[model samples]
Target: MDLMQWYQKAMSSDAYLEYMKENKERTASILEKFSIPEEDRELLERIGEHSLKVIAITEDWCGDAMVNIPILLKLAEAANIEVKMILRDENLELMDQYLTNGTSRSIPIFIFIDEEGKERMVWGPRAPLVKKVVDDENAKLPPRDHEDFPLRKKEMIQRLGNLYSTDRTIWQEVYDSLKTSLVQSILM
Candidate 1:
């Protein structure tokens, strides 16, 4: 079945809300702070006449998704795009279609479908700038450090959380770039 059909199937069975309801922690708090900027509002306008459907694979417990999906939703909404979310665990086949590094099943992988139901663009797993921070931090670490690794994990999560919370512009740029690329591809 196509993604829209899958979205309908997930929605009718209440699976969609189940995931949203389970994500109450961050989603609730983020709603208050999340705002689509004027620049990004302009970016969305460039989408032109294309009808886009963003099908997201996410899970409630994902820290990255908690930070990213809401922003994407707001920007997409500004562009009159429709977004449907499905949990990663429940949609492994769909998740598999858009993996990280060709092997890892990553949450928050958004598969963009056109009005014809063809997959057009994909964005995901994490924001690119944030991923850069993570990559830089990981490169500095001992590859297999057994000592204090758990402590390091805690520190890293805290640092990444700080990265997302403080560096708000990156998310908007991410949306801008994503929308720009989609428009470029469509116009190409």
Candidate 2:
């Protein structure tokens, strides 16, 4: 099927918003707290003129999705871009094409497309800075075979979740990364 067909079959932004209301409290929280920075507002407006759309391959349960999707939604709103959400597990056909490291089936991949449904850029899973922060945290974990590993891992996930929810610096990093990519793809 063509890209438009895929987009037509996917969940609309309204439908995705309704779907999130059921169990995506974290995502909802992030949306409530996040906003496009004033300096970035004009950039989004400029992007809006292109009439772009994005397909977000994701699921509600992913912590990365919980953090990143809201930012995308906000940008989409300001930029007047449309978004269709395709559940990764249900749409492995598309998800497989954008795997993290060509191996992991990571959620929250954003595929930006123009009005003609031509792919412009792909972004996802985590920003470079975000990945570094996550990797550094993971590096401190004990070996899997160690007795403290399980507890440490669990605690680490909890801490990251907490940080993702409350830290505006991380949110700004996410915005900066996406802005850079969008500028390269649409402006420069």
Candidate 3:
């Protein structure tokens, strides 16, 4: 099924609606905190003018998905950019192509593509910075209980902890970097 269908189906679920309602205030606060600046607002206009397509993979049951998806949707709305949401497990082929490290099925992977269908910027729950920390050679990381996916809950918690600990600085960096990248991609 297409992304719209997936989104409709997911929204139809009571659990999904409940999740959104429960986190509405927190989500709004985060969006307000991360408001794009005037300079970046022009970049957002460029992103909208380019009319790039954004494919987002997410699931309702996921906490990270719940948090990030709302932020993404709000960003798209503010920028007037088009977006499509899809469930990860429901679409294996697309997921396989974009899945990191050939295994992780993390959600809210935002895939940005230009008019000609060329990929430009991709961002979401798992950023490269976090991945590097998770895979550090010198660091002793916890093992995954499930053989299928190593570093599930443990890594997720660690990532969340790291995020909370350094949210202000890291979020600013990520926002600026992403804005610059998106602007450059569309302008180029």
Candidate 4:
């Protein structure tokens, strides 16, 4: 099915609702406080009638998804665009097609499909700063050091948690990038 079909199906799905409900804390963290700036709002408005579909391949329980998806959702709403989500586990074939680094099956992959279901762009995993923290922290760990893996992971988690908690400008950054990307995609 195309994105619109999937979107309609997902919206009324009890399973999907359960997923969202289960991740209420994560979702609330973003949805409760996030807002679009005037400039971002104007950019979204310009995308009016572009008939875009943001096919978000994600799992509700994913920490990254909870933080970033809501920000994209806000932009989609502003642009009057329909946002669709496909659970990664349930849609393995689709998810596999858009894997991170062609190996890691990362959650929260945002596939921008047009009215005809042609993918125009893809984004995922996390924002740049978050990715940096994850990469840098992981880099700090020594290879095959099982003894300290847990400790390193915990420390990385704490750093990531702090980053997400303190960062409000990430949303604006998302808006700016998406605006540039959308423009580029169409001009090709």
Candidate 5:
């Protein structure tokens, strides 16, 4: 199905609306704090001039989704750009068309399309490296039988902290570049 159909189906779910309502206050706070540079802000304000569409794939249960989706919504509102939100699982066909490397399915994948429904730019989580980091951390945990599993949870926390700090830098770069590209593309 097309993006609009997927969005309509996903939003029709009572559970999804409940989740959004429950998180509304927190989501609003997150959007309020999201900072974009003055130049980027001005560029984004012109996003709809060339007719661009943004389809955001996300799930309420996802931490990154909760954070990023709100920011995207805020940006779209400010730019007067239309946006459609779809639940990742419920929109597998749409998501599959843009899946990173044809396998990994990550939330908050922003698909940017021009007026003709041709993809202009796609941005979201990186591939293999992300899976590797998550897998490696999972491997470090002792089996369910280990008596000291609880104590070793600290090691897991530290590992995740290190992974996140490194990953955050990479993600930030991608996000900034994507924002600049999207703005420039729309203005052109």
Candidate 6:
């Protein structure tokens, strides 16, 4: 299928907002709480000048999406860009094309496309800092073969979600990483 055509078939931010309202409390909380910094106004304008549209491959239940989507919506609003959401599980044809590490079907992949539908850039899942935080937590867990590993892994994920909900610093990391990547892509 044509990528642009598929993007047109994706759900609008308004519909996704309704989906979040019905599906995930954490994502709704993040959306309500996150805000773009004042310093980003100029950069946001610059991004807007490009007239890009983004398709977010995501699911409400995803922890990474809990952190990333809210920030992205804030940015999209500030920059006057349009964004659409496509559920990853339901859109594997597109999700598979943007797989993380060419393996994992990571959600929250932002595919920024120009007016002609040519992909300008992609960003997603987690920033380096966020990944580091997750990795550090994983390192503290028991070996995968251990009997307690499953429980510990689930608890660790919960802890991370809690952290994402309350930690403004992690939000900033996501904002900064997204800004850097987007700015770089615009430059290119």
Between 2 and 4, whose lDDT is larger?
Answer: 2
**Candidate 6: residue 179 lDDT (0-100):** 90
- For candidate 5, give the lDDT of residue 136: 80
Q: Clash number for model 6?
A: 0
lDDT of 5 by residue, 64-91 (tens): 4545565566566666656776778877
8-101 per-residue lDDT for model 1 (tens digits): 5444113443446545555545545778777656657666357877777888767677677767767777788777777789778777777799
Q: Where does candidate 6 have its weakest 10-residue lDDT segment?
A: 19-28
Question: TM-scores across all candidates?
Answer: 0.82, 0.93, 0.65, 0.83, 0.64, 0.95
lDDT of 4: 0.70
Please list the residue runs of candidate 2 whose C-alpha ends up more than 4 Å from where it truly belongs after superposition: 21-23
lDDT of residue 29 for candidate 2? 82
State which candidate has the highest lDDT.
6
lDDT of 3 at 112: 78
Off by over 4 Å in 3: 1-28, 61-67, 114-121, 132-140, 144-166
Candidate 4 global Cα RMSD: 2.8
The whole-model lDDT of each prediction reads 0.69, 0.87, 0.58, 0.70, 0.61, 0.89
Better of 2 and 5 by lDDT: 2
TM-score, candidate 6, is 0.95
**Residue-wise C-alpha lDDT for candidate 3, range 1-188, written one tens digit per residue:** 44334334443222443445444454445656765556566667767877776777766555455455555655677577666666677777667766766677766677776665567787766445544543462155445444634555556555654463336554454455555566676677
lDDT of 6 by residue, 31-51 (tens): 788888898899899899999
Sort by TM-score, top down from the best = 6, 2, 4, 1, 3, 5
**Higher lDDT: candidate 5 or 6?**
6
In candidate 6, stretches whose alpha carbon ends up further than 4 angstroms from where it belongs are 21-23
Each prediction's RMSD to truth = 3.0, 1.7, 5.2, 2.8, 5.5, 1.4
Assess the local accuracy of residue 7 in candidate 6 as a C-alpha lDDT between 0 and 100. Answer: 85
